[model samples]
Target: MPKVSSVIVPYAVYLRVYEPLAAFPEPERTHWARYARRPDLPSYQDELRRSLAGLLPTPPVAAPVQESGDAFVTEVDGVLCVCPWRTRLRGWLALAELDEELPRPVLEAALPEVVRLQAAQDHERWLESNPDARPWIRMAVWQVPLHWFVLVSDEERAYEKGTGEVAPVLRYRTPMVQARRRVARSLRTLKDSMDEGPLVEGLLDVGRWLEEFHPRSLVELDYGGLVHVLPAGDLEDDHSARDVAEGIEALRTGDGAAAGEAYARLVERWRSVRDRRSAN
Candidate 1:
């Protein structure tokens, strides 16, 4: 990979699942177990830098056609867990969406139509061969999606204040079983209490995503570099998961006013955060 800039953080939030080493098959399981003890494990910043570099070639490729060998590693109660960085697959998925959404001229400047078409074809071929493939990580560029909050709770939140060159960090981690249960509950609450709409649909999607992972995996919601732009106070007091939970409970009890207040706070907080994109 090319040398990256000194910038330590990227403005994106990630929802990742780290599966226990035992979840993988033979050789792969041994690979990650040994990989866990390596001194030169890649950092999230390094992963972001590597991805940025991939876009620099002419007719920029959004993702490589080959699968990535890297992963995000973590430990749970002294047990190793790994989240493979499916960069190529994610790139194909993203490129396909961009191609559909952006006008021909605008997209051509960054990614020519032919390149996009080829990536799309490659992705289709991948799906044909590996029908069960699923991404372990989901990212949102500026602000985290509201439904992601349902998988966690305020009690799980962790905040690490930045010092010197280090960037501030905010995240939440929970067991996959817990995340799946909460998503199921949230979806039931929304479906029973309200009309079918985006919120219910989104939670359903999250539920499906969680189902793809090992039941022993861990789910995480990392604020990524967004903490750098937010005020220290905001990072300190943010309880979006709690807010989401309260809103759902309010709906369950038919407290429309309370639910509206909680939902309003969440929208306003994220709106301010999303507005930072324009400021940049």
Candidate 2:
């Protein structure tokens, strides 16, 4: 099958994801090299080629990481690359899913030292390079070879420890949409939320476009609905799963605007709720 690689990183790396993502039209490739590492940038071009061989067999000239990161002056395949800002140290090790032939020790051994090095100091400062010469956001990236450098992050345990939250919103690529919808529908089968049902519906409405929208934000809103406002055992309680087979059907009718509106509404509602809480 496909040989998959993983990058487990600290929550800080997740925060940086949005910054780099905003710069590109499509974030197919990741990372723009910084000046400090310009001479070595060309080497990574091969890594990119190797990484994308299976996924995208036909390759073109190296594309920018996102478009506007503070990573100017880099080398891709020995060609010079320029990033707006320095990279960052973030990310932590977690689970990895890969092909049967993939090496385990290579992946594991790489992350610990990478995380440790990144933890020690902010080696490369990450930024979403803008005209103002200031970053919309900035963080450090922790590099560990053998890991395809998807998420540059730090440790998870320390993050939660400092934040003092039970389950932090994992700053990682997540496929939480259908899973959370299933959970919401299951709860609805028994007893649903009066106010929060709409939020769940909004998420359901997004459909495929949900990926275009940040799943991380959607996950955040859902967590708030379930944990903060929704009742006890609302999500975790055992019950007959609600057959959202009807709503699922509606989503397939080619309603991109409706789907977009629903997703946007959920985000707005979340913002409103979050704002109110902050004010209190």
Candidate 3:
């Protein structure tokens, strides 16, 4: 069997409502400021590097190398980072030294079937197994030449205590909200850049795949790390997979005007949220 490695690369867009922090009394303000100034936040490239570093056999010594397409293949330290770009997000598939490198042809032939087989149960199993982890949010998974990659968000949820009451704590960071905005933006961009081609068809196929899930089921883009770069917005807004499904359909039908309008709405909303953050 091929060696499989599972790693969590931190999402690049960390959306938090920090306005309340400004209202804090003296010492509290000082304490929060310390955290705000921390330098450890991961950039998109940094997240890829970190994920590869953890799964690779040796530490990478050089920057990642881009390939003919949006994919980037690099053999650094002792492992290979097969990073592929999907829409705005980047999927990271780190291959260890010992794992046989599946040829591109083989991967292309096998991945679609593998994705279909796994998609049905992966999220359900993950949630059931990790009871203490954040609740299952949206995720995008993808398969590269040698490995399968996933960009997921299990956002914080209310915890029930022994008294059978849920905690009232508000979850400030909404990864799912940002995820929806990102998908919307990606679909619009994809529609704008391509005509009726394989790429466009592939994305439409993904949209159909999402439609296969139950209404309440969480949908994943399944493009490995490539989905991570999609635009994220304020956590207060609610977004669902259906929104993405509609966007895909619009794009497929050459409804560029409608797609553009949706993208404009997302951009305007997120911009307002950012402006508020700046004001705070």
**Best by the lDDT measure:** 1
The parts of candidate 3 lying over 4 Å away from their true place are 1-9, 12-194, 197-233, 238-257, 268-280
Predicted candidate 2 versus true structure: per-residue lDDT over 147-252, tens digit per residue: 1111111221121111233333212222235334544453353133234454345444333323333333211111211233322332233111111232222345
Across residues 1-280, which tens digit of lDDT does each residue of candidate 3 receive?
Answer: 1112234343222211112333345774565455444444222344344435532433321113321122222232332222223211122221211125566566444343344234334434544764433211223222111000011222422211212231112122223334344444555666675665654564454444333323323222222232232323222242322233444456767897876765565555545544644554
State the lDDT at 136 in candidate 3: 18
lDDT of 3 at 262: 55
lDDT per residue (tens digit) for residues 62-97 in model 1: 778578888989989988899998888878767757
The order by descending lDDT is: 1, 3, 2
Q: How does candidate 1 score on lDDT?
A: 0.86
* lDDT, residue 66, model 2: 34
**lDDT for each candidate structure:** 0.86, 0.29, 0.34
The deviation in Å at residue 255 for candidate 2 is 33
Of candidates 2 and 1, the better by TM-score: 1
